[model samples]
Target: MSKDTIKCKYIFEEDYNPLYVNGAQGGINSLGEIIINFYLERNALPKSQTFSVENGKISKENIDKVEPKDLKNSFVRVFQNGVVMNYQTAKEVHKWLGKHIESLEQIIDEQKDKK
Candidate 1:
C-alpha cells in the first residue's frame, strides 16, 4: 500500500433509529431553499383513556375524550422530521427517483405478463 493510501468505514450513532413515513409537506423558506417535512398518517387516536378494575379478572375501560361524529372518516398526520436542501440537490433527487420509479413500474408489468 502507498504511504498516502487510506480506508474508511461508516457507522450509525448510538441514537440512530430508522423512521417510517408515508407523507411529506413543506415549501421553500426565506433563503429560497426547499424544505420537506416527512410524516406518518393514520387514524386519529383518543386524547385520553381510563380504566377501572373490580376483581382479579373483572375490569372496565373508558375513553374520557369524546370522539367527533365524523371520526369514522378522521385521520391524523404526525410529522417526524424535516430536511432542507438547495435546488441542485432537489433536481438530483428528482432524477434519481424518476429512474427508480420507472424501473419499478417495468418490474410490475413483467410480473403481470408472467401470470
Candidate 2:
C-alpha cells in the first residue's frame, strides 16, 4: 500500500453478502462506504449521487439527475472485502461507533502519523 492510499481488510460473515444488496461493493466498504453512507443518508445528503461519462467527459446533467434507492436494489454482485450492510446493520454500526469514536479516531490518527 502506498502512503496516499489506505487499505483496510475486514472479514464479515457470508450473510453480509453484497449480492441481494448493492453492485460493485467491497474493498474499503466499511470505513469508507458503509459508515460514510450511513451518516450521509442520516444528514439528508446521502452518497447516492452518480455520474455518467461520454466521450471521456463526465455528464453534469446526468449527475444532477441521480437519486437514492434501497441498497438491496442498488447493485448486483458480491463484495470482495467488506460486506454490504442493510439498514439494520448500518444502524447497529452507527450506534457502536458513536460509543467508540474516540478509539477509532485515535487509530486513524496513528495510521496517519506513520506517514
Candidate 3:
C-alpha cells in the first residue's frame, strides 16, 4: 500500500494576537453547526467602590484607600470568540485534540519521572 501527499507553502499572518483561554462553552446553533466559545475564567468584578479622601496638607495622601464593595459573585467567564464548524469538522477536531492531549500527558509523566 502507498499513500500520496501534497506539500504546499504556508504563509504566516502579519498581525495576530495570541489569547489565553481557560474554558469553553457553546452548543449547536440554528444552522446545525458546532459552536465552541472560548473564554477566560476570572473573578467577577465588584459592583461598586468607595474612596476615602482626606485633606492632609496639600493633597489627600500618597495612596488613597479605595475599597471595592458588594462583591457577591464567585467567578465569571468572559467569552472572547467562538468557532463554528460542521459535524465532519467537529469529528476531525475531536481526534486532533485527543492526540494532542495524550502527547501532553505523556510529556508530563516523563517530567515527573525525571524529578
Candidate 4:
C-alpha cells in the first residue's frame, strides 16, 4: 500500500482517561508517537489504541512533568502479541510488527476474494 494511503486512527485522552493526575502529567503523546513510528517502520498502517485525556488546553508545564522513560515503557505494551511475547520489549515489538503485517496481508486477500 502507498504510504500516503495508509490508514491511521487516534484515540485521544477524551476517549479514555485524562493524562494529567494531581500535578503529574502522563506520557500519552510520546507513547502515541512511538506507536505510530512502530507501525510506519514495519510498513503497517497505524491504528491507535483507545485512551482518554481530559478536556482543556494541556500546558507546557503539565507536559514537561511527563516522564519519557515511563512513556517508552508503556508504549512497549502495544507490541506484546499475546503469545510467547507476553512482555513489552524491542523483541515483542518486532513480533507485533510481524503480526500486523500478516493481518494486512490477510485483509488484502479477503478483499481480493470478494472481487
The lDDT values for all models are: 0.84, 0.55, 0.80, 0.44
Indicate whether candidate 2 or candidate 3 has the larger lDDT.
Answer: 3
Task: Give stretches of model 3 more than 4 Å off.
Answer: 1-5, 11-13, 53-69, 72-74
After the best TM-score superposition of candidate 3, give how far the Cα of residue 89 lies from its true spot, in angstroms. 0.6
Q: How well is each residue in 8-87 modelled by candidate 3, as lDDT tens digits?
A: 99887887677899999999999999999999999877554444455743443222222243345367899888899999
The prediction achieving the highest TM-score against the true structure is 3
| Runs of candidate 2 exceeding 4 Å displacement | 1-80, 103-115
Question: Highest lDDT among the candidates is held by which one?
Answer: 1
Tell me the TM-score of each prediction against the true structure. 0.70, 0.22, 0.72, 0.25
lDDT of 2 at 110: 100
Candidate 1, lDDT over the whole model: 0.84
lDDT of 2: 0.55
Residue 47 in model 3: lDDT:
52
Among all windows of 10 consecutive residues in model 3, the one with the lowest summed lDDT is 61-70
lDDT of 3 at 59: 46
Clashes of each: 0, 1, 0, 6
Candidate with better lDDT, 1 vs 4: 1
Candidates ranked, most accurate by lDDT first: 1, 3, 2, 4
Model 4 score (lDDT): 0.44
Clashing pairs in 4: 13-52, 13-53, 14-53, 16-51, 16-52, 17-52
Cα lDDT of model 4 by residue, 2-112, tens digit: 565667898667556422212211222433322221211122322333333457643333433444524433432223111122225545687888999999999999999
